[model samples]
Target: MITVVGTGTGAPLPPDAEAAVAGAALVVGARRHLAAVRLPEGAERIVLGPLAPALDAIARYFDKADGTEETDGQQETYEEKETDGQRGGRVVVLASGDPGFFGIVRALAERFGSRRLDVRPGVSSVATAFARVGLPWDDAVVVSAHGRDLRTAVHVCRSRPKVAVLTGPGSGPAELGAALAHRSGARVLVVASALGDPAHERVERVTPGEAAARDWGTAVSVVLCLDESRVLAPVRTVAGPAAGPDRWALDEAEFAHRDSMISKFEVRALALARLGPRLGDLVWDVGAGSGSVAVECARFGAAVTAIEKTPDGCDRIRANAAAHGVEVRVVHGAAPTVLSDLEDPDAVFIGGGGRELPAIVTVCARRARRAVVVAMAALDRVPAVRDALDAAGFACDGVLLQSSRLAPLPGNVTRLAATNPVFLLWGVRPPARTEGVPQ
Candidate 1:
C-alpha cells in the first residue's frame, strides 16, 4: 500500500503517521521531509526531485516482490508479503500541508489506484499563512502560481479583496508586487516564507511598491495579497466573492460620462450576459468611453482593464470606477497597439473602435477565451465587424437596440424620447467538433 502523509508546518508527526513511517520499506519525499522523519535502518529512501524516477523505482520494488517484471508499458500489482515482526510491503510518500490539496497524493493515486493508497492530510499553507496573520480565510480566494502561469493569480489580487497565492521560484512576492505596482487600488502583500520551519518562518507585510523593490530569495512559500479596507466584510451570506451584485446594468445617470458617451443600459445588459464575467476571469473593455461596461463587469467579480485613447477618458473611467467602489485598471492608450501588452481576456467588450473597429474586433476575438461583444453606433460598420468575427472562427449574432425612455413634458403628460439606435454584434466561439468513424 502507498500511504501519503502530510507534515503540517514542522509539527511532530501524528502517532498513526509515525507508525506508518517507521514501517515503510520505501520512504519518498522532499529532502526536508525525509530528514525530519525517522525511518528503519533497512528502509530504502528516495529524495524527490523529479518524481517520475522515484515513482518508477517504487513500482519496480513492488513488482519484484510479486515475481513479475513490467513490460509493454503495462501496470502490475503485488500482494503484501508476510514478514515476521514487520510490515514488509508498505510505501510512504511525505508531503507538506494537506496532501490532498494540490499535493503529491494526486500523483500517487493516479499511479496506484485510490483503493491501494491512504491519505493523511494536514493544514494547508494557505491556512497556516492566514493563521500567522490572525485573519479568517473562509472568504479568501486561494490560487497557485507553482509551475504555472502567474497572470491568473495577479488578476485575482487585482479584483478580489483577499487572496492567498501559492508561490513558486519565479512567481513569488516580488513578481506579484511588481504586477500590482501600477494599479489604482492599494494592497498589502504579506510574504510568508519557509513556513513550518521554526528558524526560517517569516511573514513580512509590505506595500506593492515596497515588495517590488526587494528580492525575497527562494525560501518563500505563500503570499497573502489583501485590500485592508475590505479584509473583514459584513457577516457574509455565502463565502468567496459576494453573491453577484444586487443590481447590474445600472442606469447611465449612476455613472459619470461625457456628453452621453456611455453605452445604453439595454446594450450593457446584453453585453454583460454575453461576457458572463465572474471570479478568476479577466475582461477587457477596449475603447472604454465612460467605463460603464468595465465597472459593471468588475461589479460581477471579474478583473477589468479599460483601454482608452484619450487621457481624459482614462481619468473619467477611473473616477466612475472609484465612485462605484470597484477597481478598474485604466490604460490610457489606443487598442490593437496597447492591447498587445495587456493580458489575454476571457471576454471582451468593445464600445468604441473609431476606424479600427474591424482590427480591434479581430484582436479581441483572437485573444478572448469565451465571447467578444461589440457595440457600433454607425450602421455602415456592422458588416465589417461581422466579417472580422467570422474570420476568427466565431459564431456571430447581432441586434439593433433602439430604446425610448419616458420623458415628462407638461401637465402631468409623458412622452417617449427616442434614443439613437446601436448595433450590438457578438461572436461566440463554436464548441469544438469531434470526428466520427466513416460509414
Candidate 2:
C-alpha cells in the first residue's frame, strides 16, 4: 500500500500520516516538503522532480520491501508489520495542499491502484487564497497553469469575475500578468507565496500591470484574479462555470444594432454552431457591424473580442454587451491587421466584410485553433473563402440560407416576407467536429 499526505497548507501532520511516514520504506516528496518534516532514519528518500523518475524509485523500493526480488514489478503483500505502534504502507508520497486536488495523489494512484492508496487530503492552495481574500469561492473558476498552456487561464480570467491560477515555473505571475496586463487590466491579481509557512508566507494584491512589472520568484503558490464588481454572484447549485445559456441566436431586435446591420438570427445560429463557444475559449468576431454575433458568443460563456473599424460600432457593441450582462472586449480596428495584437482565438466569426471578407477569413482561419465561420451575401466571394480555409488546412463546408418571417398586412392578415439569401461557410479543424447548424 502507498500512503499520500497533503501537507503544505500549515496543517499539522495527522497522527495516522505521522505513523505512515515513520514506517514508510520509501518516502517521496518535493524538496520543501522533505525539509519541513522529519523522516525515520535510513528511510529511502526521493525528492520529487520529474514524476516518472520518482514513480520508478518508489517501484524499486516497494519491490524490495520484503527483502526478496519479486519476479514481476509487483509489491510483495506480506502481512502488515507493526511500526510506530501501527501498521503502514511501504511508500509515502508527500504533496502540498490537497494532493488529491491536482496533486501527486493522482500519479501515485495511477501507478499503484486506488486500492493501494490511503489519501489524506488537506486544504488546497486555492481554498487558502480565497480565504485570505475573504471571498466566497463557490462562484470562482480555478485554473492551473502548471506545465500547461497559459492562454486558457488568461481567457478565463478575461471573461469570469473570479479565478484562481496555480503558478508554475515560466507560467508564473510575471508571465500570466504580462499576458493579461494589456487585455485584462480591469482585473486584480492576488499573488500568494509560500503557503503554510508563517515566517515566509506572503500574499500581495496588484493589478495585472503591477504584477507584470515585478519578478515574482519561485515562491508563488497561486494567483487569484478577480473582478471586484461581480465577485459575489447569486447562490449556485452547480459548481465550475456558470451554466451555459438556455437559448442562443437571439433575434435582431434583442440587440441594439443599426438598421438591421447585424447578422440575422438564422445566420448567427449557424455561425455560433460552427464556432462552438464555451468557457476557457477565446473567440474573435471580425467585421462585427452590430456586434450581435459577438454578444451572443459572449453569452455562451466564451471570452469574446469584437473587432469593429467604426468608433460608433465599437460603442454599440460595448453597450449591447453590457445590456446583456456579458463582457466583450471591443477593439476599434479592422481585421487582418488589428488581429495581430490579439491572442489567437479558438474560433472566429467573420460577418459582412465586403471585398475584404476573404482576406479576413484567411487570416482568421490561420490563427483559429478550432474553427472559423463566415457570412456573405455575394456568391462571388465563395471560391476565395473556400481557398483560404483549404490553404489553412481546414475541412470547409457551407450552406445558402433563404428564410421568410411572418409579416402583418391590413385586416389582420399575415403574409411571409422573404429575407435576403445569405451564404454561410464554416471550416473546422480536422477530426474534431461539434453539433448543430441551422438550415
Candidate 3:
C-alpha cells in the first residue's frame, strides 16, 4: 500500500498523518521532503532527485513483494496482494502542499493507479499565498510557472488583470517581475514567500521595476493586480472597432498599398462581425493587402495571422501593425498552400482569391473554427463558395456592400463617388454543445 502525505505549507505533517507515514517501511520523496520528516526510528528512506531513478525504486519495492522479476516498461502495479510470509510492507510518498493540485500525487496515480494509494492533502501554496495578501482566491486565475513554460502565464497576465502565479526557484518572482516591468501599463506586483511557516512569510508590494530588482526568496508565488484605469496608449484605450468610425476598419488612405487595393471599410466591418475576434481565439487573414482587418481584430485581443504573397504587402502589413501597436503575425507567402504548415486557426478571412476562392474556403472551413470570404463582383465564384460552405457543414450568410463616399470633385464641389460593390459571405461552425447560462 502507498500512502501519499502532504507536509502542509512548509509545516510538519499532522499527528495522525505522521503516524501513518512513520509506520511505513519505506518513504520516498524529494531530498528536502525526506530530510524534514523524522522517520519512525528504523524506516528505510529514499532520496528522490531525478524522476527515473525515483520511479525505479518504487517499482523495485513492488517487485520484491510479489515474487516477480522486474521487467522494463512494465513498471506499474495497481492492486496490492498478500505476500508469502504474511508480512505486508507499506510505502509512503511525501508531497508539498495539497497532493492533488499540481503536486506529485498526480504522477503517482498515473504511474500506479489511484487504487493503490491513499492521499492526505494540506493547504496549497496558492491558498496560503493569497491568504497572506488578504485576497479572495475564487475569482483569481491560478497558474504555475514551476517546471512549466511561462508563455501561457505571460499571456494570462496580459489578458486578465488579476492572476496568481505559483513560482519555484528559477521561475520565481524576479522572473515574473521582469516580465511585468517591460509590459506596458501600470500594475501592482505582490510577492509572497514561505507562506504558513514559522519562517514568517514575506509579502512585498512593489512596482514592477522595483520587484525585478530584488532577489526573491525560493518557493514564491506572485500575484499581479492590474490597474485597468491605466491606459497603454491613446489609440489602444479605445475598446473595440465598432465603438466609433476611427477605431476600426480604417480609411483606405491610412495604409500604403499598390493600385489603391484594400478590403474596403464596409466589407471589413462585416468581416469583423462574422469573425468575432476575442481573447483565446486565433483568426487568420488570408491574402491580406494592408492588414487593416487583422490589426483591428488584434485590438479586440485575438491572436491574428495574416498571409500575404507580395513582399511589399507583408512589409506594409507589419508597418501598419507596429503603427497601431498591436501584434499581428504576418506570413509572407501565398495561402491554401502556405496555410497548410500554419497552426489551425479558430476563424479565417479570405480577402483576395481570383479562382482559388472555392479551394481556399474549403480548406479553411475544414481546419478553421469559422470562415468569412470576401469577393469583388466575381459573380461566377459565388455559387462555388456557397457550395463549399454547405459541404463543410457551416451555417452560411452573405451581404452585398455598396458604399458611396462623398468626395471633393475637380470643380471643388463635393459628390458621392460610388465604389465597386463587394460580396461578403460568412460561415460559422456550430458549437459542439452548449449549456445555457444566464447573461
TM-score, every prediction: 0.86, 0.92, 0.56
* Maximum-lDDT candidate: 1
Please, what are the lDDT tens digits per residue for candidate 3 over residues 281-339? 67788989888888878777676778999999999998987787666777888778988
lDDT of 2 by residue, 2-60 (tens): 88888988988989888778787678999988987889987778899999998987775
What is the overall TM-score of model 2 with all chains considered together? 0.92
lDDT string for model 1 (1-439, tens) is: 8888999486778899998888888889999899888887888899998879988988887776665666787755555565334345688899999988778877888997889788888778989999999999888888889888888898889998999999998898888899888863889999998888888899999998999999999888899999999898777657766677998899999999999999999899999999899877899999999999999999988899999999899899999998998899989888889999987898999999889999999999999988999999999999999999999999999999999999999999999999999999999988766788333
For model 2, the run of ten residues with the poorest summed lDDT:
80-89
lDDT of each: 0.88, 0.87, 0.73
Whole-model alpha-carbon lDDT for candidate 3: 0.73
Worst 10 residues of 1 by lDDT: 79-88
CA lDDT, candidate 2, residue 9? 84
2 or 3, which is superior by lDDT?
2
